[model samples]
Target: MLLSGELGPGDRLPTERELSTRFWMSRNCVREAVRTLSSMGVLESRVGAGTYVTDLQPQVLLDGSSFVLELLRHRNVWEVMETRRVLDALAASKAAGRITAEQLSELRELMATMDSALDLDERIAADLAFHRLIADAGGNQVLAAVLRTVAGGTTAARKRRGLTDAHAMERMHAEHLLIYRALERGDADLAATAAAAHVAGVEAWLLDTDDSPADQ
Candidate 1:
């Protein structure tokens, strides 16, 4: 209600007693609900001023997504990657149609930076940024939020697997370039194909490495 503009930020909520009576619910239930929303950054309680709607920024709402992804890291690596691939493929398809020329140029610049990023940490950061840019180009906040969570999870999983390598980085650069080119040309099919192929390449490499003796 608050986020949808039914209630505005800084607008004080009704008193607990009034809420309980009006809603015909126990005060305890309302209190718990408010507490949960507060924890999620959807509501704020001011000491005497009363509770009000929060700013409801994307970052605030999606903050718990990272933590959830982290907890699910080891349990289903392949599943996580599969989910990411699907999301990214959809994002790429949409971006091909929706992205602006300026956004395409920005992606080109990020790709260029990734080419020279020799350090593992730098490569990871650049890689995440590239994917995030694609999500942003899709022009959907919910999709972008989901992509951020998956990207963070992928980073965490890569650290645990010790999977960063020069070859992997090179492959990523090439794959990203292909996807960017497709989007630049405004070819939705090609963009989606490139995105899927890129993710599949990573999936194959990770699986091959996992089966290798050293991974055991």
Candidate 2:
């Protein structure tokens, strides 16, 4: 209904009993359907009124994606990393051509912050900010939203292993510098390559570690 235009933003949904009868489903099944859609941000419920279709914003719809990724990380950590690798590369490539002067300055500042960070957590925060700025510079809200969720989903795995080893941290900083230089030069291909390599390095380190996701 939503895809076909039968339902739209602010359109009130039929009562559960009505939907149950029309679809030949039990009321409990109808209720569950409504609940699932609500969680996906496709529907909104009011206290005195009833359920209605939501605005269908990308950010809202994708809000739960990170949680889903986190829940499945134990079995699909590698796949999650692979997805991030692809998205981060694409983001970097687009950002190379589209990034503004202000964004570039911000990236430079973030790099400095990472270099001077006194603690692991502070360094990690700077690292995340650098990637997020790249994503925002790409000029695609939907892509940014999805990439943000994928990044968040992998936070636990990264925290567990990616930044712990001194050698790995040094290598990652070098890779980050390469990515920044590529972006600074507006070289889309190099930016993509550098971003992909950085993420691949993280994957390599995680794979070599025992990386017991059960603990994550």
Candidate 3:
């Protein structure tokens, strides 16, 4: 019904008994189906009311993606990184044109956090925030939600790469400066190039060291 447009956001689903009778299925089966849809964010069950179709927002639908990606990342590390690079580039390009003064300030703060972070863990957290802020500033909630998942899934592997190289964080911070400068200048092409280049460095290193458990 949702795909066929017979049902939409805020539309209440038929009762399980009605659905079972209409579809010639057992009531238990109908109940199970509703439960599954609810878990996927396609349906909502109110306390005093019955099931209804949800708003179907992309962020809501993709909320569990981080967990799924974490489970599958080991087998598809390259694919995940590739997707992240493309998304990050898109986010940076869009943000270059749309970023607000407040967002720019926040990015500057995050950069400062990275610069003064006392340890690898603190630096990593700041690094993640910097990318996330750009994605949010892009004005595309769906893109930001997806990057949240893909970037989060690869965090450990990326951190491992950071751990192995003594100078990795310094080089990464420099790349980040280039990206931030492009965004500051409102240069979409430059922002995209810089974002892709930053991710590409990690991608190349990941591919070269994939056999290592640390890399995986």
Candidate 4:
């Protein structure tokens, strides 16, 4: 009922007695279900108030999966890149056809920010924003959340373990411009290709060094 939109976020759940009576189940069964939902972050219990649905935002729902993402990145970076290549390409392709003018503007701004970034951290920040905007423009919250999870999971760890410099930032800036231009032209195929190439470059760098994901 909750997922079907019968009950939305912030809606209070029925009392345990009401639920038990409505469902023809015993109070113990209802209690068990409530406990399970709470554990999943789908429901919350107030100190004195009744239970309510959680906010249901992707971040809230995906927070518990961060450790899983960390485990995947630590165990295999190729797997991470493999997953990203598909998702990033799909996001770029969708954004090529669906992106709004405002989204395109934002991406261009991020490109400029990446180009002018004096330090590695600033460049990375802009780079993250660029891809996130593309994901948002793709119009898929679930995919965006998953992408964020993996990106966040590996970004710092990879930087710490792999070698990076100003030259890398410059290269990323140039590559990002190609992606933005593809989207600007509404060329879905071109966008996907550009996105794949950009991701492949990063993978090459990560695999080029002696350090690996597990080392971090």
Query: Superposing all C-alpha atoms, what RMSD in Å does each candidate have to the true structure?
Result: 3.1, 2.9, 2.3, 2.7
Candidate that would win on lDDT:
3
On the 0 to 100 scale, the lDDT of residue 77 in model 2 is 78
Highest TM-score against the true fold, candidate: 3
Q: Judged by TM-score relative to the true structure, which candidate is superior, 3 or 4?
A: 3
Each model's TM-score?
Answer: 0.86, 0.81, 0.88, 0.84
Query: lDDT score, residue 101, model 4?
Result: 97
Error of 1 at 120 (Å): 1.4
Say what the RMSD of model 1 is: 3.1
Query: For candidate 3, which ten residues in a row score worst on lDDT?
Result: 206-215
For model 2, residues 81-120, the per-residue Cα lDDT tens digits are 8999999999999999999999999988988897887777
lDDT of each: 0.80, 0.86, 0.88, 0.83
lDDT winner, 2 or 4: 2
In what order do the candidates fall by lDDT, top score first? 3, 2, 4, 1
| Local lDDT at 15 for model 4 | 96
Can you rank all candidates by TM-score, best first?
A: 3, 1, 4, 2
Looking at model 3, how many pairs of residues clash?
0
Off by over 4 Å in 1: 1-11, 55-59, 159-164, 211-216
TM-score for candidate 3, please give it.
0.88
